[model samples]
Target: MEFFSKLLFLHEVASSHGKGLDELLIYVHLLMASLFVGWLAFFVIAVFKHRRSVNPKADYVGARSHFSTYAEIGVAAIEGLLLLGFAVPLWAKSVDKFPEEKDATVIQIMGQQFAWNAHYAGPDGKWGKQDVKFASSTNPFGLDSGDAGAKDDITCLREKFLIPVGKEVICKISSMDVIHCFKLPRMRVTQDAIPGMSIPVHFKPTKVGDYTITCAQLCGNLHSTMRGEFKVVEQAEFDKWFAEKAKAGGGGGFE
Candidate 1:
């Protein structure tokens, strides 16, 4: 009952991007379960029927049947097709760049050894100029000074990312140190935040709630503690919260 409840909850919570993937996942699970049941039944029946005591003259053939060979081929083909047709596409959609849309909220995600630093693009929508050589307590991103767009940006190492529900959010992710993955299971998203590269994941929360963002990759000693969350709120409330954070002073890198 508990497992079924979780599955149902997942289905309900993930109606948008997760529905199709979940259906395909269920189909694959059912197929595998059926195969397991059939194998178990066949093996049990064979063992009982061909017992040494019951059939002292039983044929000791070790070779499998032609049907088994064809079954193996069929299973392989199905797995290949499912991976190529379903999983690959879902994965691509999750990590690919967000579509160009006006007024889209841009969030920068910086992954470090044991924390996630989330930064907003601010009102400019374009990151202020940065000098890569400038590295210190004040300039963590090593912004290239010549790139004039990065100056007024606000950044925060906030424990939770707050965004408006129903608004399209594009998260641009990068890593400061080693490779780390941004994983949001309920959102049907997981992508590597690699050093020197930015990956984007776009989504609009259908419901307002707090969702976890966990590091999927093992990076360091405290990798397990590297976690974060985001709150999906109404547009007006989100704007207020964003403003408060900005007023408090934000910190992180932008490009």
Candidate 2:
């Protein structure tokens, strides 16, 4: 599986569930490859067998053997197994299953024209009050100044964010403007960010390192610049950073 994954040019797996996704990809591709070769062979055989010189007359009655029907059924069964036995189970186990908030890192990420905004509830485990009226270029989270919960919340604008390694991170993704796709290739995570909607997705980071975030959608003129950064670090390092960001009052803005 590793050899096939590398051959398919998949990035290094950073999330706990990434290898499963990679394996599914490899299997799907291998099935497609097999179908391609087999169909090509049949095409060549048909052309040669039905050549004009070999059979000048056209046969109106096309009678085929039951072998073809059985083959088709066999292919369909294999595909069903791939979907039911592997794909569906993986989706259920990795995607549908949600880790408890108390045991996970929950954050909100908003996508704008050419950047990302990340919001954290801080160490208090309480999210700040947010109103669309208070939302602006600098205050993407729309945090109410009068709300005590807002005081300790952390917001990082177009900057790198940190998550503890070996912990599940639940990201609530949203789009401030047009539709965008939040993609983390190494973690095998991708979720569509649509306006007026917040979608939640979770992935457990397994490797401690820096990872790149990309917008898979063609957003706008500067879509290519819609990039973000993520760092998976030790629990202590993440805690220290989180504490400092909270102490900074979670104030975020463009310079």
Candidate 3:
């Protein structure tokens, strides 16, 4: 199963919740394959057994046995179990079990036509005031220069963001223009970035490495270029990186 998953290009599990998603995907594929093979076998048997040279009698009442009905009921039961027992619970956990802000590394992501603008609240742990009127090519976050919290804020373009491994990281996602999707395959995280709405998604990176961040939605002609990097590191390394950015004035402008 692991080999097949890798062969299918599934990303390695790098989060606590990622294994559950991987298992669910593998189970779904297994169920689908079983159904396909079962149907193919039945079709082949019917073709050979009911051929003219064999059972020439065409019975008016076809398939008098209750096996097909039982099979259909069984399939429905399995589907219901997969939905209620797995899918629904996973969704509820992802949407409702959000970590506390104080305990999580919080960041903001704003999506434009073909780029992701990432913002960190710095040591203050409070987001700065933003207004669309202040938006510019250089200042995509629209941060108000007069706001005190805005001074220490860090902003990065094209999705170069960092998070500490083994810590809960929450991202508040929004869009400046059309709808976009933020996808981190290794973390099993995907959320839509909608304009005028800020949606939160959280995950815990179990490994320290670079992960690909891609826009799963086609927002514009340049949507294919909407790619970013997510680097997971140790807590001390993450702190060092943040300190360096802070010392450099914390993403004062586009870079």
How many collisions per candidate?
Answer: 19, 0, 0
- lDDT per residue for candidate 2 within 1-255, as digits (tens), equals 878987999999999999889988988999899989988998899899999998999989864668778878988998999999999999999999999988999999999888888999987889989888888878877788778887788899889999999999999999888999999999999999998899999999999999999999999999998899989999999999999998875644422
The residue-by-residue lDDT of candidate 3 on 152-191, one tens digit each, is 8888777477899999999999988899999988899999
Name the 10 consecutive residues with the lowest summed lDDT in model 1: 246-255
Of candidate 2, the 10-residue stretch with the lowest lDDT total is 246-255
* Highest-scoring model, lDDT: 2
- 139-230: candidate 1 lDDT, tens digit per residue: 55555545545544567663677878777778888887899999877777778999888887787667888888889999999999988888
TM-score for each prediction?
0.79, 0.96, 0.94
Of the pair 2 and 3, which is ahead by TM-score? Answer: 2
> Candidate 3: misplaced stretches above 4 Å?
55-57
Give the number of the best model, judged by TM-score. Answer: 2
Question: lDDT (0-100) at residue 154 of candidate 3?
Answer: 86
Q: Using alpha carbons, what is the TM-score of model 2?
A: 0.96
Q: Which has the better lDDT: candidate 1, or candidate 3?
A: 3
